[model samples]
Target: MHRSLCLAALLSLAASSALASGFPVTVRSCDRDVTFEAAPKRAVSQDINLTEMMLALDLTGQMAGYSGISGWYKMDDELKARLGDLPELAPQQPTKEVLLGADADFLFAGWNYGMKVGGEVTPDTLEPFGIKVYALTESCIHIMKKDKSSMEDMYTDIVNLGRIFGVEEKALALVDGYKAEIAKAIAAVPADAPVPKVFVYDSGEDKPFTAGRYAMPTALIEAAGGKNIMDDVETSWTTVGWEGVIERNPDVVVIVDYGDVTAEQKADFMRKNPAFKDIPAVKNNRFVVLPYAQATPGPRNVEAVKTLAGAFHPTVN
Candidate 1:
């Protein structure tokens, strides 16, 4: 009995020592290096896209709750089912109070998606509350210089998240699956077919807000054998005059489906407007509506590539 008790005590002591040491993880969030001595006990992610990232890693058990979901867009049944009992802390951008209330030690979000540039709920603001921030790789452009958005950016986020949460194997597997699926989808496209010119119409009537060269949709369009007509915009999502749309005369117009305005309404506006009458897409009535979840950078991007590939190359599959 004495020996058994001593063994238990020694094992307990060793575990206590290991716990004290913790797992020191260092990852690059934007231009800065943020390190965590241990995996966060409670994490909060903003926006459906970022939330989906965490869900992909099966990290709901590590999360306190999610924010910035139902307020902007309807939470789909699949996401709701996945969430199960996980609560929505805030319908929109979660404040410091919400984070503190839930005792969230980490936040997985990006600029504009949740924490704005120099906004109230930025990394600096949350630092005082002991909440570490992991900025989305694609949104790094908002703060620092970055090469245009690519599949690699999303993959980097997944890999880093896995590292942070001790799920590197799952992350690597997911990324590999994405890479294989994407390559297969792209390979099936006809080499002889002309690449379609795709105009991403996110929203706006007077001046159309569209995806630019640095946006994930640009990469999505490229992968699907199409070109973003506004690839020269120099920024991610931005506003450009209708004159440019008319000037470009894209072969297909992709509508971003979200917010108060329906995709059909946005399409109707373009179709009825005199300014867009001569536009090739308008004349040809070739408009594809992509859901907000799929259009943005996330795991859904892989499925989006397949969808866009089908639209861009009707002859293939």
Candidate 2:
């Protein structure tokens, strides 16, 4: 009986060793001990941002499902044509049944909130089914122990995603090109010129939702030769009273159009708002509308900066 017990323990150890050796190591946002079996053949992306990054890296062929294509930021025509047949993975938080029924080899996502809120899918949740998950570094709330984040973090996320997809070379090339363009644009702006005071009007309905210091809107403002009027506000977003806008009286008001809101509606809102109309931006008609995708820190945010610079300094043209 003693010999049989020892033999069984030895067999178990060997089996554990074999399993460990067979699985591939994949580091993600939360912690690193994730393991997978070779490259995933079928992938499900929960956010459009991750989907776009995968497509940029030429890994869209591996995608079995995705979410958030119809709202906010829609996929480009070429991608739509190519991926017309794949299943829609539901908006925001998809059901567990849908996620599991897809039989995806792996799951990639930009926002953890989706899972935390209602998706009911977590790393441990998928582990029993032999599914692996990776979170975008940009969307990671904790990393390097920083409260606020920057555009460099987005670049790092893109590169990390590239590494996971085995397309590091392509990702690096894209990052390098974007950085070069941004650097060129920054150089064109004279250092001595005063930065324009800008307000990022993210949403304006009953109460305006504006970007504060802790987000990409602030970074975009700095990049565009402007100072975010809300730079002193420590939070990522804030709902402000019309009196607050009157007090700030910004030089430029950048309206963040989510495409869900039309330019006409935004213009009407600005003109009709009793408190905002008297502001310099509204009075002088220096309102600039930026797309929601461009305003957010991602692979395309630098382009948004260029657009802003051109709008702010049209005389340079």
Candidate 3:
């Protein structure tokens, strides 16, 4: 009887061990490959979009907190609810002190989002502090020579995050869902539908700040059956002369709603400006407002693409 009881205990222990997570998983981040011995217990994600990536993975339990969200971007009710009780460590960008103080084991940041090139808070600087930084794939253009941004870049980040957190199934499922949802949404547009020429109006009175081919919006616009007017600019995000805007003559202007200025205000500015009077988008009063979170790469991109598709093909859906 004693031997049987001991054998049963050993079997139970072995079963538990078998079910344990496989550690030391290696994931590619930008040009470097990183290995994680175990899932991060305390991770800090930077920016609203990056934080949403972590949240979409149901990784709130692993997060220490988030940074660079509430600073420039307005938090939506849905996002706020998902991040309940999670502290906003930094209003803008995080300092090395903040990560070290939180005892953060990992950081999810990008080039322009959180860590700038040679900036104070970068992957190299944070490495010595025991904080492993996962670079946002879209922002890799700052450091590495890469192809133009694609929806696949976002999917890659989601899958890699899942692998790092031991939730591969959930990540892949979410990506599949996004792809299906986008396909269904754009199905309303006819195959021979004219591809609308779109312009992304972020901000700037002197020169318009817009996204180029390297930015996520290029892919989003393409997925929505529209072409970005600035796709040939070779920049991710930069200012362009109004002459270029007049020359391109975008059919629809996608307004990014964020900061102090309202989307309506931006539209009003475009309509009032004499220089933009002849522009197709402004002349026709065709404008679609996309929330900042939705415009950038993250979970909200699928919905953003749907919004653009509906706007670009007005009669389709």
Model 3, range 1-317, lDDT digits (tens) per residue?
A: 69999999998887666457756689999988988878899999998989999999999999999998778867878888999999999989999999898889999998898888888998889889888989999898889888887899899999999999999999999999999998897888899999989999999888989999889889899999999999998868788998998899999999989998999999999999999999989989999999988888899999998999889888877
Model 1 lDDT tens row, 1-317: 69999999998997787566545778999988999878888999999999999999999999999999899875889889999999999999998899999999999999888888878899999999899999998888888889987889899999999989878789999999999999999999988889889999999987989998788899999999999999988888889998888888899999999888999999999999988888888899999888898888799999999999998888887
Candidate 3 local Cα displacement, residue 303, angstroms: 0.4
After aligning candidate 2 to the native by TM-score, how far in Å is the CA of 205 from where it should be? 1.1
How well does candidate 2 score on lDDT at residue 259?
Answer: 51
| C-alpha lDDT of candidate 1 relative to the true structure | 0.90
Reference-based TM-score of each model = 0.93, 0.80, 0.93
Model 2 regions lying over 4 Å from their true place: 1-37, 71-79, 82-84, 117-119, 142-147
Question: What shift in Å separates residue 57 of candidate 2 from its native position after superposition?
Answer: 0.7
| Candidate with the larger TM-score of 1 and 2 | 1
**Clashing residue pairs, candidate 2?**
none
Query: Which has the higher lDDT value, candidate number 1 or candidate number 2?
Result: 1
What are the lDDT figures for the candidates, one per model?
0.90, 0.70, 0.90
